[model samples]
Target: MEKQTPPEQDTIFDEAELLGDGYDKHVRRARNTIFVVASVQFVFGLVLGFSGPEESKWISIGIMSIVAGIFAGLGFWASKKPYQAILIALILFCGLILLDVIFDPASIFKGIILKIFIIVYLIMGVNNARQTLRIKQALGKE
Candidate 1:
């Protein structure tokens, strides 16, 4: 272990090293993906607010803004807690998608391509974070 990793550096993220090497790549990707999700959600909320029924306009916008805020917060948290943040983002995104499908079966066909891409990217990010953490733990790093 000593030969595999430098001895001087210690980090607060459960001893996860943040400096050097390419270990931060997955975390960065996860964080960026989260921010992108938030941005898209917010924009969708805006678009829906104007296009949807008048009665639900404000409500829909409010709910989406809140969801977007949650993602944004997780993105910021990823800098300090990559594993937890990424995991939560993955679960939340999946859960929301599931809920949408459950509530509206036809919604699945609405944006099939975009939905697939987002799910794939989030899954990849989650997998990357998991592997990175495992490797760091093995090396006595992250």
Candidate 2:
């Protein structure tokens, strides 16, 4: 096995080198997609907050919106600080899942809207996992 480079000695590559070869453009495109997806979730949350139950649903919607906004911000931050971006994304994801469990204990498919959110969240997890792996590989940590 190759020796791990000392964190202090190793230079952090810019986002371009993080993607390697021709993948930087693809990474940017992925970030754009993440932004779009998060924006959609944010809009959905607003709609739910305005239209659903005042006590429970609105609270859930507000949390969802906050999570979505965080996700979008992470995408933007990834351009400048990819490692921290990925870390924040992972934490946000865990928080989102926990929120979902707290808000919808009766399974995400109880409502079509909730189901859609669940699917979107699952996709977000998968996408984030791929991005994390890419970042790790680029850093020679994988």
Candidate 3:
């Protein structure tokens, strides 16, 4: 007599749910996208801190360092809580850009292309994160 394989055996994981091939690709991209956000924050902090004017050097460094730390924290959080972390990152990024434009309107045009690219990536991350969550829920995964 032939025996039947268990349902879990047919899935990618032993018990936990896994994203399908296409969804998996999107989710992987989302994870990498979040890392990009964190890395940019870190590089920006270093650059601004070191090259800022002498008078406000310490202040700039302190502020940037804190901002970088927050991004890094969110990056780590993305591994477990992708949707929430990425959403917050996107909002924070846009808010910062808005603040810059408010202080100096011309700043909006500075590296506008890069800003657009980052914003697009963050949006993609948000979409992918939502799909991942939906998949997990549909599979009845915790």
Candidate 4:
């Protein structure tokens, strides 16, 4: 009779399985955070658009409100597929920052600071989603 050797345990797989639940929770929290922030931005944009004087600035505010609505919609979709949402959000944020810089150079410093904070927050959410997905893939390989 021939003797068979058992396959060696993979440390990576073991680690992933151990952390699988935690990763799921992390992803959930990140998704929720994104949703909340997006919702807030949408509401704020709406208020700004409507509460402002009926001047030319209202047109700009309306455009901003539209962008915010798109961001909120993206956030809702991101709950299912986070990575894509993160990319789109980052792109939108960058475009907004560029427009602000071009139109209101005097507030460049303030805008840059706010953008940095938002970018960091978005990156953290992206990282959580990515790590959770990676762990899922690793465990699936087992």
TM-score of each: 0.76, 0.51, 0.79, 0.63
| Runs off by more than 4 Å, candidate 3 | 1-18
Shift in Å, residue 21, candidate 1: 5.3
Model 2 lDDT on a 0 to 1 scale:
0.63
| Residues 1-142 of candidate 3: C-alpha lDDT, one tens digit per residue | 8999865533456323355566556555656665776677678877887898888877887787777778778778888888888889889889989999999999999989988987887788788788878767766664
Clashes of each: 1, 0, 0, 0
Predicted model with the maximum lDDT: 1
Q: Which stretches of candidate 1 lie over 4 Å from their true place?
A: 1-23, 139-142
Worst 10 residues of 1 by lDDT: 12-21
- lDDT score of model 3? 0.76
Question: lDDT tens string, model 1, 1-142?
Answer: 4557556644444434443335567568768889999999999999999899999999999999999999999999988778788889989988988899999988878888877777777667677677777767766865
lDDT of each: 0.81, 0.63, 0.76, 0.67
RMSD of 2: 9.0
Q: How many backbone clashes does candidate 1 have?
A: 1
TM-score, cand. 3: 0.79
Per-residue lDDT of model 4, residues 1-142, tens digit only: 8999978765535664565665556555555555655665667666876787768557857676677678777778877777678667767777777877899887568746655767776767677767766665676742
Clashing pairs in 3: none
Give the alpha carbon lDDT tens digit for every residue of 16-114 in model 2. 566554444444554565576578678878887778877788786878788788888888876765556655655665566567779887644445574
Among all candidates shown, the one with the greatest TM-score: 3
